[model samples]
Target: MSDNSGFFERVYEVCRKIPEGKVTSYGAIAKYLGAARSARMVGWAMNSSHNLEDVPAHRVVNRNGVLTGKHHFGGTNAMQQLLEEEGVQVKKLQILDFEKHFWDPMKELPQEI
Candidate 1:
């Protein structure tokens, strides 16, 4: 496996912790994993996670809560569709009431980062 594969698994682990109806950002996950500058790595992880069954990759968005990764989900709106199914509203590819639905792993997870 490539070095990225390990980090990708770590990203997926953090993703699995995101609750239903809640959303987090690539930056948030990276920061939580103690790699604050690795937000793009988290995005890469999400892009490669489509085939996984329980990662809930839809729950992740850009820091501003935009569905920037929507294109990776097979359909133009599949990411938004999944979020909507989880009770999150999206508008113009951005999540509505973003802060209200935001899930910060740094805050939600029990361990210190």
Candidate 2:
């Protein structure tokens, strides 16, 4: 595994902790991991999360709560569908009531360092 493999594992751990019906941003996960500018790396980890059954990548989105990675979830609507099933509303590829559903790992998880 590359050094990023550890980063990806950490990302997966954060993603797994996202409660059902809530969501978080790639940037939030990156910042939680101590790399504020590694939002794209968070996205990259998410792209690999599909192989893990419990990663819950559907609970992750862009800062605006847009379903930017929806296409990776098997179809254009798959990610949105999963969110909707969990009680989150999506309209025009954007999460409705985003603030209400937002789950920040930094706020929710206990500090490890």
Candidate 3:
């Protein structure tokens, strides 16, 4: 695959590894993919990844735990509901007490995958 395609695949692979109800930022994803400043690129790829079979796009959000991708979700307010159902409290589009629930995959992820 070309570099762009490979990068997207890598993004999807990492995104797929995120557990349900958990969220990670585009910046973090980019960092994990060795593209520390390409968070916007990651978001672009995600926005265009409608057919990806493995990426749970809903489980990814902004660095502040904001549901910035809610517009792309399948149902109205589905992203928030999904996170809440997963035990995350959300208010005004903010993940309540984000420091408590944010999953730093960079630190928590295994060295080898």
Task: List, residue by residue over 12-108, the lDDT tens digit for candidate 3.
Answer: 8788888776778899888877788999988877886778766778777899888888888774898788788888889998888877777666886
Q: What are the runs in model 3 whose C-alpha is more than 4 Å off?
A: 111-113
TM-score of each: 0.94, 0.95, 0.85
Candidates, ranked, lDDT: 2, 1, 3
Candidate 2, pairs of clashing residues: none
Best candidate per lDDT, number? 2
lDDT for each candidate structure: 0.91, 0.92, 0.81
TM-score of 3: 0.85
- How close to the true structure is residue 10 of candidate 3, measured as C-alpha lDDT? 79
Residue 61 displacement in candidate 3 (angstroms) = 1.1
lDDT of residue 26 for candidate 1: 99
Candidate 1 TM-score versus the reference: 0.94
Candidate 1 vs candidate 2, lDDT winner: 2
lDDT of 1 by residue, 5-88 (tens): 988998998899899999999999999888999999999999999899989999999999999899898867888988999999
- Clashing residue pairs in candidate 3 (N, C-alpha, C atoms within 3 angstroms): none
Global CA lDDT computed for model 2: 0.92
